[model samples]
Target: MTSAPLAGCILAGGLARRMGGGDKTLLPLSGAPMLARVISRLQPQVGAVVLNANGDAGRFSRFGLPVVADPIEGFAGPLAGVLAGLRWARAHHGEAEGVISVAGDTPFYPADLAARLMEARGPDAGRIVLAKSDGHMHPVFGYWPVSVADSLERFLREGTTRKVLAFVNLHPNTAADFTPEAGAPDPFFNINTPEDLEAAEARARIEA
Candidate 1:
């Protein structure tokens, strides 16, 4: 079945503590900024793409797309990024039924991700859809309904300290199972530290 079209969001507003204080999205991986590769992969799948980055949007202007900041402060993690994307989608692409978010540090995401995720959403509204691989769940790569703005806002205002999975557990979430291509490593690998960046480069070379 054909899935509903989605708005793609690259969650690039993190502090990058593990990779030093710089923006991990701008870091090079396999000769391309990690953010660029993510855009290239998602652009074809979604109706439109936006960067959810904070502080000085000019840095991402070269990408020639809208960059939005979290409505809440104190860097509330990926959930805040998700909220920003949902807000953008609602304002710009209100007709879009949902938004798909991927961390900027993850460049090797699956090609069929949007379809798989939208499929998992089923008939539910405000449902979260996450990807699972090798018995581990990658909550950062998922689809969320645009209607979540109010709940997310309330969570932020209430000073909720729950992690992404904990917040997700509060709602019904469908886990999409994806088997790695024969001999291919997991596609949702994320770069967090210097060692992870090196590993991603090597993996990219092998996949290329």
Candidate 2:
């Protein structure tokens, strides 16, 4: 657990353009929906989990989590999803001091994600901590403080660029390095295409 309570947010709003446009997270991974694997990894690390998605929330009903859409419309990018998650945590998970945002298609995220993020924080109360693997920062797998809800909303509503790093860079932020286990892929490896999914399965097989 974090020194402060935390909520989990799975960002699933991407259009999956490279994969022919659809919910890529719902696609199969090792005989089960990829998102099911995501939930399993993240659920243990936070107080509660919410799905950040857009359109037809009913499609995710089976997951039995509150589905929140980006507060700003027009597929405002992962930053919007992060903003939505922060607002939702502030409103519903009021006890949560922050929210952890994970990319829904990235099923291999580290199991100790939340704990490492908390460790990466400075003495401040609301530092943003992102995951780093092999020197690359995965901003989508981030810890966002509920206190940044208003600033994030303003960033989405007011800024022309919607990149997650743009806003994250504006604040106190650091990355928690994750060393790949022997025979394992980078923890933040995500499936974005048919070939990528095949590669993921092959990698999973190697690890198994």
Candidate 3:
């Protein structure tokens, strides 16, 4: 089946408490900002791309992509970033069928991510799609319907402050599994702490 038309959003608005409260997306990974690498990977796969950030959108203006903030208040987490992205997609790419959300810190995201997730969606099933690696689901890296904004808003309103997986499970969705290949590490590796950054640098060196 043909894949749906998708727009991409890099979730960069997280309160990086674990990374010492700085913009993790702007952190250097292999000499380039992690956000740049992520945009490079996602731009070719989706119709449009935007950065979802809360404070000082000007910090990301150099990328020349539109910056969107959470429509809800107080750093509600990735789900808020997703909601901002959905609204941005609807406003900017009105023809887009769905929005594919990816973490800015994940630079090695699968190149076929959009196609794979779109393929997993079925008629009558909810419009959420998650990625799986090593038997664990990565709900943040997935496709979401633009229509889900209302439901997500309600969830935020009810103070349902849980991780993305909990929200996904409450809806109907499928997980697309991917296994490591040819000594390659998992495509969903995320750099949250300094140790992860070191490992990712080593992995990049090896790949290079």
TM of each candidate vs. truth: 0.92, 0.94, 0.91
Instruction: Estimate the overall C-alpha local distance difference test score of candidate 3.
Output: 0.84
Which tens-of-lDDT digit does each residue in 64-131 have in candidate 2? 99999989988788988888888888888789989989999998888889988888885666899998
Q: What is the lDDT of residue 93 in candidate 2?
A: 77
By TM-score, who's the top model here? Answer: 2
lDDT of 3 by residue, 53-94 (tens): 887898997899999998888868889889988888888888
List of clashing residue pairs for candidate 1: none
* Clash count of each predicted structure: 0, 0, 0
Clashes of 1: 0
Tell me the deviation in Å of residue 111 in model 2.
0.5
What TM-score should be assigned to candidate 3?
0.91
Candidate 3 clashes between residue pairs 3 or more apart in a chain or in different chains: none
Query: Of the candidates numbered 2 and 3, which has the greater lDDT value?
Result: 2
Q: Which 10-residue window in model 2 sums to the lowest lDDT? A: 179-188
| Model 3, position 91: C-alpha lDDT score | 86
lDDT measured at residue 1 in model 1 versus the true structure, 0 to 100: 18
